[model samples]
Target chain A: MASSPTTLRLAVCLFDQVTALDYQGPIEILGFLDPNNVKPDVPTPSYLLEITYLARTLEPIKATAGPRALADRTYDEVGDGEQFDLILVPGGQGARPEKVPSSLLEFLKRQAPGAKHVLSVCTGSWILARAGLLQGKKATTNKSVFKAVVENIHGYGIDWIPKARFVVNDDKKIWTSSGVTAGMDMANAFLEYLVGKEAALRIRGIVELSAKEEGDDEFAEYYHLL
Target chain B: MASSPTTLRLAVCLFDQVTALDYQGPIEILGFLDPNNVKPDVPTPSYLLEITYLARTLEPIKATAGPRALADRTYDEVGDGEQFDLILVPGGQGARPEKVPSSLLEFLKRQAPGAKHVLSVCTGSWILARAGLLQGKKATTNKSVFKAVVENIHGYGIDWIPKARFVVNDDKKIWTSSGVTAGMDMANAFLEYLVGKEAALRIRGIVELSAKEEGDDEFAEYYHLL
Candidate 1:
């Protein structure tokens, strides 16, 4: 018998001061791509895309975006046997190394084993690093905060890949992007992976977003000339 | 005689689908405050503040928070002669209203009279509202769209208010708050002019938010009962 198509379960982590765009950009894209919203003219196959705000507890988490956002369930709500197709960690001021709660770190550690893909935006990589997930993975962050991430964290064996606008370090099942807006770029890439580039491109056209390459080739070419 | 510390001229106008809470609520309080964020540690001085977002223009505007916002400024700019202490507008999805160009609205209006106050949060309220003197309006944004403000538009509005639970609608002589946050509750009754006791108290504590009181007790009891 043919195996049933796997449903994509995406959990976006949230906390106080979390940058609004970090989640909003990707969320909006995902929400738009949702089969429910697809116009009759568009051909979208049925895909169970479940996006949830994974918080530490059931309490409503405040977002940098004006109103508070409530999570569908707490980190503890998901059982050990449960698996997620993707785990998206959005960055913000709240993702500071010192401020990330232990509960969140523990949740990250527990979920990593089952997550088919672990993605992060901007400083969100910091939290994954805290969870010991980025030890050997290549990652990136906001350009301004790049230096601090390199100097502040020690002995992780992680490849500090600066210069690249965004990096896909598939070896660790981790994908990272620079700054907050780039989260949409990364999400688009992931969407291409799930629904094929054509569908992702269609969504991009609908949203009026420009296509962005994953790595920084212009800088690399400039440095080579020198 | 000194003219009472020069009235902090503040304005927050209405627009269609404009997140009513975003503009009205914040402007209400900022107009009532002393401009220093100085409260008596108690909510008592909820009596003095003057702010307005009058539709000086006939331009149809859009808000990022929801739908369209109407502009009060009839002229291209808030005339060079009339300097305002502070000027603001809110954001909604209306920023992209049909046949309306809010950016043009923002571009034409000059800052009130002098180096008056200028502010906005969430979307391009700062860019589209046309608050003059934004060249140096120490400001923070909704975090998600800060880049659009900082990069797409030039000049300062950049003293990022990190601690502000909302935007501070601050201009040389004015202040703004982030759109749709608790700032609305604070704006409605606590800003410059006092809003009666019961209404003010109802919005302040976040409690009794749903409790509806139709007119005053005497009016309801005596008139309705009869």
Candidate 2:
């Protein structure tokens, strides 16, 4: 049954003071798609995901929330020749600052254009926006920092939605989700789109995520983002 | 607020090929309680939690799913006197083998008893059981590996529940959850129990977790574990 073999290259951007859940939520829900994470008895046939953790530096950087992660490659190393199919940028207190890292912004600006899909969780969109990539793009951000993001990124000419758990630009294939846990919801939906509803549901069943929905979030109302 | 001071020490155990989400989900949810993660505008009044990551070796260990993390301390370094208020053990492909490392089992055996709360996510319960910790206790494991867990650890006399997302022996303060994302749900419930519903709800609102519930799991039916 195997026909043409393809490898999906995913770049998970890491940085100092990153939020653990924003990136982790998406990685957890979607990480299984990495063919390397296979079940021995289940007969998955084959694996197709090739993940690389990219950061500005090679050193281990601690997130503001907790947990220090080591990047597999630096942005400069993955600079020119290498390109990705998917780029996932997760936000946190680090992204909350007005002066975001130049290297990070430059990396996103450089690599995101060539990728098939550019996804951001929470404030990561702010990074993409700072890179000038989200200009004329529809996106959303963490509600806890709702006003801050809405206020800060207005200069980029991006259309920021107030009440979405996530927003997608069908034309650009750029997906952005609200706060920490909301990324998981968005990821579950993205998985449904990437593989098929049946496969996504199969994954949700294993994780026991019965209540995850595409737009079933309440933070917009709770935080008065709407 | 200045009248009294208190600190809660938490120890998160890490291992080779550990699932990043399993450890990260709980860390993300609970990391906020660690006073250092305070928001200046939020006025949390004061900080009170200290976290330490413990592993068999000080070197970075790669999660079976993805991401490499650094442990704060080696298990040998965190000797008998260094007790913790909470101990979290997350499971992964690493825990599936019959012969897990003796040091990790030894560390859990030595440290968990002294903790106010001992929690395991997904197959981490298997490690707790393997350490001879969950005997005569109610617990659960990853539904995908349900038969493996039920078959492997039956001799330990654990009351393995098939349907619950998470099960806790209130008196013992032992909490165990199903697979992967179930850890986030368990963490939300635990936050509610720890800091009161209002505070937990506040945290949940920030993260925008809509479907995180203690018993809101469906893996048993999906996996045919029941």
Candidate 3:
């Protein structure tokens, strides 16, 4: 929001059985916001992101598919008034109602209210819906299991879109995406919103990503969600 | 190669300043090979991958941008005769000659010969090239910094291809990909090779990845590498 270099604190939520790609895809795209990784001649970057990986504890959190990721801090460790500019919740088997930790939902309920923006990858929206954040909101989730997941989570007061790669809330405070790799596409658009199109394009160019738009989802049709 | 279920051990090399996406994109795609994630009625999974993250030390390996990854074992801790079915080398700022650890190169040199498949994402090929493993082999690296990186690494004798998304040598033992996100495409193709086209397609469909072929690179033209 400033001409001078500004830093945005990002809180990445991690839990056991979390899909590594859900967080990794977005983190990889957003990592380009680091000024050190950006070109020196770019004058001032719109924002330099400072990322913090949060988990229930400081121990290594095992992903659904294998590979363990270490968290920087525990959700309980954050002070009462502490807030971040961005919050990321990734989905996996851990996102199920029975498996999802109440502590995480509580953390999100606290942090999301104060955060500038909240993002959920795949069924992470399920957790958000479970936490009552998605009530009266428009969102989408992983399509392969769309019917099964969305049908059971009744009375959330959410408008679930079936044929979209990602959907943003009317207020623009919340962003949600389809299955795994869609996080990268959502993140590309999210970066464009945060920085500018030019900056986002440069980042995507370096990573060689052909950013797909919100309406460009083919999986929606393939899965017969449309 | 067995008809019955078989687990392939994967060694993921990590270092300070390594780009997270370089490995994450591929690992995410490859993780689906796990039988647990696969449908029970699918009969038999071609291969189930067991991933092991390796680093110079047991401490968290900080990436070039932000966030840190924990390693399962130190390279030295791996037994002398131990072998991995698949070895992954990911690149970032740390992949440079001065920044890379000697121990990593030594471990790669020792491990690669015994590996069934050696994969390098982004400038991870630089590491492979530096390890003297790319000699008399065809390969590709991240295109943005391609010229500068390959030019300086003299006498590796690698037939560096400038206009490809990824390259596989005559023997198909080594696979090198262009830039960060291109690793996913490489992994997609690699999955098809390891498993079957049907299985890879199912995995990609669930992840919603519109797989890109080897020559579907626009970066080559964008960077004037062609």
Number of the top-ranking candidate, with TM-score as the measure: 3
Q: Taking chain A of candidate 3, what TM-score results?
A: 0.95
Alpha-carbon error at A65 in model 3, in Å? 3.0
lDDT of 2: 0.79
Residue B14: error of model 1 in Å? 13
Please, what are the lDDT tens digits per residue for candidate 1 over residues A92-116? 6689977776777888988887888
Candidate 3 per-residue lDDT over residues B55-157, each given as its tens digit: 9998888887535778889988888778988999999889999999888999998999999999999999999998989999999998888998888887778
Q: What pairs collide in candidate 2?
A: A35-A47, B35-B47
Query: In order, how many clashes per candidate?
Result: 61, 2, 0
Q: Write the per-residue lDDT of candidate 3 for residues A76-109, one digit (tens) a residue.
A: 8887777898999999889888898787989998
Give the runs in model 1 whose Cα sits over 4 Å from its true position. Answer: A1-6, A217-226, B1-226
lDDT of residue A130 for candidate 2: 80
The CAPRI category of model 3 is medium
lDDT of 3: 0.86
DockQ sort, best first: 2, 3, 1
Of candidate 3 chain B, the 10-residue stretch with the lowest lDDT total is: B35-44
Query: What 10-residue stretch in candidate 2 chain A is worst by lDDT?
Result: A38-47
**Candidate with more favorable, higher TM-score: 1 or 3:** 3
Best by DockQ: 2
Model 2 spans > 4 angstroms off: A40-47, A97-99, B1-5, B40-47
**Which candidate's lDDT is highest?**
3
